[model samples]
Target chain A: MKFSVMVNEGPYNHQASDSAYHFTKAVLQAGHEVFRVFFYHDGVNNGTRLTTPPQDDRNVVARWSELAVEHKVDLVVCVAAAQRRGIADADEAKRNGKNADNIAEGFRISGLGQLIEAGIVSDRLVEFGD
Target chain B: MPTVKKMMYVNRRAPHGTGYALEGLEVVLIGTAFEQEVCMAFIGDGVYQIMQGQDTRAAGMKNFSPTYKALGDYDVTRLYVEQESLSERGLSVDDLMPLTYEDEDDDWAEKPSVQVIVRKELSQIMAAQDVLFNF
Candidate 1:
């Protein structure tokens, strides 16, 4: 089965991101295709490379990046939501006249149309949020 | 042609208090561009989103309640408001904004977009959807 995941909350503060990551990993391990993982609202924080958790704790952002690199999952952060929350990619940061970008590897900034497209193409669109 | 999926955006939060209602509306607006059969459901505190007389000037927020009016132009006509939810919140249909749309197939006759249904009915409607986006 093909699946699309939506993370609607930021990492650490809520378990939504962790649950979404584990669900995506389990889906891949089960041999199902992940159409995309669309991040919205505070969830866009997951795409920022600036995240620095305690060394002993699991790095949520890095885990998502590694998942994308290893499984080739499409991780998309909604541009509008990201801009509102200060999570910007290199191109977005340049366009918005920001000095730096913080978007992590294996993620792309995009419009909400990507989320709609995921709902259209994926067999299941799963959301994790408060 | 892309398949037309029945996509429903479920709102369970009140507006202004959290960013969910506003961001959820953004998704609905963007989804309409995909030309899918889209609908919105307002249950629990979400019913307050479409309530009339929402003023955010004092709160310093961009009162986006009026954006719900523009959904019809995007061919998004279904706004399901749960009857029980309203009663639970001490509100009625009269408290909601009179959202309407012109039916292109029916000689542009203006029709009501908000449908107040029982929870049971809303459940069936949810079950019929190809995708359900909860906010």
Candidate 2:
């Protein structure tokens, strides 16, 4: 079955990001297709490469990047939400005149239309949040 | 034509203390471009979102309550407000903004967009949806 995931909370502070990551990983291990993973609200924080967790802890942002690389999952961070939270990519940082960009690999900044389109195409759309 | 999916945006948060309500509304507005069958459900504290006469001046927040009125223009008409939630919060339908839409098929008559229903009824409606986005 094809699935789309939405992560609505930031990493570490909440288990939402962890839950979404595990769910996506399990879906892929079961040989199902992940149509897209749209990050919105605080969830956009997951796309920032600036995340630095304790060395013993699991790196949430890196996990998502690796998932995209290994499974080719479409990981999208909502542009509006990202901008509000200061999670910018190279292009976005330049356009906004920011000093630097922090968007991690395997993720793209986009509009909320991507989330709507994912809902239109995916068989199931699961959300993880507070 | 693309397959029309029944999409439901479920709101469970209040308007201002957090960003969920605003962001959720953003998604609903953007979703209209996809030409999908879209509807919104206001449950729990979410019913407060459409409450009439919301003033954010003192709070220093943008008053987005007016944007709900413009949903009709985007072809988003159905807004289900849970009746029980209203009573639980000591509010009634009258407390909500009068959101309306013009029906082109019916000589452009203006009609109410918010429908007050019981939780049981809302649950059935949710089960029928192809996608449910909760905030």
lDDT of each: 0.95, 0.95
Across A30-107, the per-residue lDDT of candidate 2 in tens digits comes to 999999999999999999998899999999999999999998999999999999999998899999999999999999
Q: Pick the candidate with the highest DockQ.
A: 1
Candidate 1 residue-wise lDDT, B82-117, digit = tens: 999999989999999999999999999999999999
Q: Locate the minimum summed-lDDT window of 10 residues in model 2 chain A.
A: A116-125
Question: What CAPRI class is candidate 1?
Answer: high
Q: Please report how far candidate 2 places residue B118 from its true position, in Å.
A: 1.2
Model 1, chain B only, scores a TM-score of 0.97
Provide a comma-separated list of chain B TM-scores, one per candidate.
0.97, 0.97
Give the distance in Å from residue B65's predicted Cα in candidate 1 to where it truly belongs: 0.7
DockQ of each: 0.95, 0.93
**Model 1 reproduces what portion of true contacts?**
0.95
Across residues B1-135, which tens digit of lDDT does each residue of candidate 2 receive?
Answer: 249999899999999999999999999999999899999999999999999999999999999999999999999999999999999999999999999999999999999999999999999999998899999
How does candidate 2 fare on TM-score? 0.98
